[model samples]
Target: MSRIPRLTPARAALAGDAAAAQAAAAPAHDADIPVDPQAGAFFDCDNTIMQGAAIFYLGRGLYKRKFFSSRELARFAWQQAWFRVNGAEHAGHMADAKASALSIVQGHRVTDLEEICEEVFDEYMADKIWPGTRALVQMHLEAGQRTWLVTAAPQEAAKVIAGRLGMTGALGTVAEAVNGVYTGRLVGDTLHGPAKAEAVRALAAKEGLDLSRCAAYSDSSNDIPMLSLVGHPYVINPDADLRRHAREQGWRIRDFRTGRKAARVGIPAAAGLGAAAGGTAAAVAMYRKRH
Candidate 1:
């Protein structure tokens, strides 16, 4: 098995870090050092492992079940598209998506949501996963390293995706529940930006992981904080902002989206389909409001 290598964030910011990291990863005597038990791999779900947003996928599933109206779906799509275009999340967009999602699940049983998420993953998300990113995840698992998914989607949905992918677990936004039903409220802030970093730190503490030996992968610049906390930071299928940041930081980058359309839009290939399904240009109004 390949060893889980280490590279400090301070060094990684330097141009020479790439060569240094590669050299450190494969030594003269490969068998002398084994993968560290304390090493872990943390990946952002949206656009990193999957092609688009997990919340958007969950919303689409709920819409199919008549949990929400067409208008609501349109609005959700707009928020997600706006996020994709900007390469980071907007506070207002997140609030709207969170409120809409929580409201739909307010009186529903948690088990029902889990079941729906499972079906959604099989139908909508299974094939949408980026092959390159999935390969990296498999590599980590093969190396005996624990792998976790960090996302802003509901904890249940995130758990379902992680379980399906055979990952260790997930860290996601927690919605309050009572008597097995959603309460239409969140336990704390949504897992985005600095919140993602906090979640990673807490998970590392609980899992006894050494941040200096761990790795983090994401597509958005919003994940910089979380990426900075790890020894190996990789930007996968990065958005424009993240692409720029990754270059500046000298971080490793992997883009799985193919062809000119993906290059032109600087987003996942599924985004065009998502936008079309969300309602044409009418939803652009919703995107404007959030900005």
Candidate 2:
């Protein structure tokens, strides 16, 4: 495991508040690209649309429902606290988080889990949505383009969010189920990093949309692949690494925390690309939609 760097009190609080502030803000960045009705707009669920991570809330609900033991909750909480204050302790920490989340839902009825999601969502998740992102999603839908929530969150919860938001649907990490009961085993790799990109490509193929005409919005570096898969990529409330990446790659970047209304492209693109590729700093996760 890699050592997490110490954070000053101010920095830690700012990191935590960034997502919520973003969610409550008005839509500042407008993606004024050529709209193609046949194409899709893919939005990353966590951080991108939601104020923070949904997994944290899911784990909390599971704990309250006694799905996991007290000790397990303590350990999970400690890990989460560590991750929040410090970022991933190890490179595999994200993988571990993914696995543990799947395990948390193992053996639960899919329908039951969906109901729980609804409860969790209603109790709190509903308010966590970033209104700015929702506006963009609505824009895509109103334009007759398919809008989907692409997320690392479980498909059940992701579907719930998409349905609630009136999106076309969702593409999310699948957990295997038998007889409508979860098997606690994933169907494939956790949809992060390169896997996200692959999922978008498959979806694009299925939808018969031109890749260049599609748009993707994300905040995490893990979703870089997904963002790059589309021609119109927007980085929203971006982590430092992703913001740097976007700047370098000439992708449109939006920082809702700032007063910037439009994405700077031409000059910033060339300038950002001229800089060196920075290290993959452990990013503060924006928990949201639990979607």
Candidate 3:
């Protein structure tokens, strides 16, 4: 049997001194760590792992660095706002927001983007995690589950977070690049909605995983397809629509936003997610107001 690995948000982060220590300590940072079929848990990023979208976190960092004009930031913010609120039902909004996010990175070096994401994560995202979600990741990890971050966020950001949290690896939207230079386009469709389900399936096939026995978790209604693809589908901090859907479909639900930190986890036992929506509170406020 493959041995279980240590996959928790490095204790330093959990202790509140998080940021630079975790990333620098993870050796599996950018590599694609293979998953073992016997045990695996696929987690959606953004609101599921962290408190908000990784791209929004990255965008704010870029804006502070003067990487883009205020006008461009405004435009991106608008698209992101629409995406955050209506994305579950409006596929078009996410597409537009993703396109704009990719365009913002066009002409930038992949290496530079990595550095930026790292810095952004260190100073911002590392501490913005939802504790309940972290607990879930820990549950899977301690049980020998190869937890993977499945998100529409860029691979760099996803990998950074996964590595910091000591997860197996990440499957995210791939931006086309050559010789370390971005091609200003995606290699394929952004890994969102149905694409997310497809990515998980492809990964499962490669990892020899039986999808029927695996677990998946997410906060958006847009992830319904991905959620449905697994045996244990958890609706974490679900939006209203997703909450309603979970009730109707008899899916397990955990709402950290309004309820007490989620108790009674899957296995091995762990504390629930704490409310850290305030860590990324500023950006989230903007998204809420814009919508």
Candidate 4:
């Protein structure tokens, strides 16, 4: 929420278009990463792969471009604070965020949004990644397993993050688009909870992957369905529910907070550590700007 020069919608659209073109023109994937056709690893985005939600970064980018008003930004910040404090996804919070996002992009060109997402990743997301989780992704790539990011964030944002991280690909909420224009509608349910499991199942079938040979990781109990689908399941920086569940199920658990150790770290303590590491201070500064 640091004040940058405001952009008119027309200027922002043009800027976004240019950025999209640049991203499109770049290399698509890392050719050096070997791929195993029958096995793959899936990962969650928010809190699992990164410090905060990718969608929140997207909202920051859009707000800077003046896509929404200050009030909307405040609402977005409040929702983000809730997520940070709870360290879990709430149905009501996701719905409110989804509705607000869809309304903002209703008449926009798909390419334009993609373009802005590229910049957003560089500006707000690059430094927020969890090194431990990233190392796990690297381990998968080294083992010749296909790596994918599965999240409820828009596909374009997921795509950008995956591409930058040199992952195989990503699966995310697909917004209905026609002739390169957003229709403000979703093609199916957001890849959340059961929907995430379904998407992974469909992908496994299409890719001819053996589920028992695959792996999955997440931080929330909400992703239990998807995690349960794979033979190897790992929990990274898990929430309270997921931590207890992982303990009960005897799954591998790792927490990359301050001490950078593998243990049953409480989410509240993790949140406090994350804040001490700058997350809370940043949120406070953002909130103060509004007042």
Candidate 5:
């Protein structure tokens, strides 16, 4: 096993609030647990590790490719913001957004999207890689923990990012494929909310990993099922509802946005501002829908 570097005082300070909350809610356990003799770490993509959803950025990229219309991109961004605020009530909207997003690339070769993912990963995502989250993943890697990127994004896109991050595996929502071409329809589970937990369980079982000893990190309250499955659950840069739950449940929280020596666990100011701005845009559209 490689030696995992200790967290910097700045990083440790950022996690202080979360550590305290966890200590109050439940006993603190080592985040660096050996699930198996060979197993490493399990990660949730989106806000947990990355600054934001890579798929969303990918959608923007598709817009640049002329695959998505300006109106459609606006709508997609609207639904995402609405979903983040309203939680599960926006499930239908999320489904519709995904359908529309995928419809934009219908009949396009998957290889083309794969190439786009490479560009997004290199240009957009590489710079936005959260340092604290990367450090956590690196710690797991050094500890001989096999890392996996589990997300609700399309499997092909997830695989591209996972490969770039050097993860051992990836499990994401599967889209239909016929004769090596995308049918632009989801063939299996959507891999969100509860489905994410189920997929993680399935992976653990397949890899002979002990779920009771494994660690899971996420940012949404919707991921409670998966977070509960692991022995150590670190809630990183959680949303409003998830932050409340994390406080109540004693989940550890880490704030990576502020690089400040004393940042708290709740949403960072920039993220809150972005969500507000995104929500305002969604509200305008939603109002237009009502009219």
Candidate 6:
């Protein structure tokens, strides 16, 4: 049997205070880490923990609902392509894409959307979970670490995917809901970049965890703020610029995608497939427009 290390109340208080200060300066909050006997490992979803974006698969659900037009889907595809080619511009493109997607889903009930997410996860997300990424998360779990998925995807999306993966918690963007129906507005700053860092801090404060001893993994330089919040930052399958930045920052890098030599190539290829699917839908809208 293995002996588990427990923090003394005095030591825990000191650690909690230190972590709180570090988190207060962050831009987003995650989960309240209670006195669990587990360490913490933060993970970025999208390309870091999966072969592609969950949103792309979830979009098929929306398409079936007539919530997305083929042309809109193509635009989403093009935006992803631009993000892959121009890594530095990813944040802007992501925000725009999310805004566009949300607009289509504005009038939906929260429960209805949840059910859709559930179906998408069962049918699509399960098959897409990358083996290497799952292995990394399993490593943390095996070591008694509470693995969390941190993403810029909406909370509803994150909740379903995280639950399916059996992760400890999920930190993602929040959409406003009024009386169980979506209000078509955001409740706070979308959980991205600095916002993600802030959310982590708030979560750490509530849970009494030490961020300095924690771990965070992601695939983009845009996640630097959140990654920097922790002591161990691993850049998995990073873009060219992010890879270079990680090297300079002394961060570890892992390529989760099989047979992919570089992040630039892998991301675009995966994104291209998603784009093509989206483009096919977009073509129908184009035809309708011309007619």
Best by lDDT: 4
Q: Give the alpha carbon lDDT tens digit for every residue of 77-111 in model 1.
A: 88777766665556677778888998999999989
Predicted structure 6: lDDT:
0.63
Model 3: per-residue lDDT, tens digit, 11-64? 333444446435633542222333334557799987788776787778878888
lDDT of 2 at 98: 75
lDDT of each: 0.71, 0.64, 0.69, 0.74, 0.63, 0.63
TM-score for each prediction? Answer: 0.76, 0.73, 0.78, 0.79, 0.73, 0.73
Candidate 1: give the clashing pairs.
none
lDDT of 5 by residue, 1-291 (tens): 223233222132223333442242221113453323534456888777677676677787788778867998897677656644543223676577578756876788878878888877767676556555654553454344567888888787788776655456798887777776778888776888899999898888888877766778887877889988887777877777788888999877776554543222232211012222222223223322343
lDDT of 2 by residue, 87-182 (tens): 222336656667788888888899999999878776657777764565556445433457788888788788878766667788888999999999
lDDT of 2 at 53: 64
lDDT of 6 at 237: 72
Model 3 bad stretches (over 4 Å): 1-13, 17-37, 78-90, 259-291
Candidate order (lDDT): 4, 1, 3, 2, 5, 6
Tens digit per residue, CA lDDT, model 6, 113-217: 888988877676766665445544433443345668888888889987766555678988888888888777888877778888888888877766678767788
True lDDT of residue 26, candidate 3: 53
**Residue pairs whose backbone atoms clash in candidate 5:** 39-145, 39-146, 40-145, 40-146
Cα-based RMSD of the predictions, in order? 13.3, 11.8, 7.6, 11.8, 12.3, 14.9
The reply for model 4, stretches above 4 Å from the true place, is 1-35, 261-291
Order by TM-score, highest first: 4, 3, 1, 5, 6, 2
Which candidate do you rate higher for TM-score, 1 or 5? Answer: 1
User: How good is model 1 by TM-score?
Assistant: 0.76
Model 6: residue 84 alpha-carbon error in angstroms: 6.1
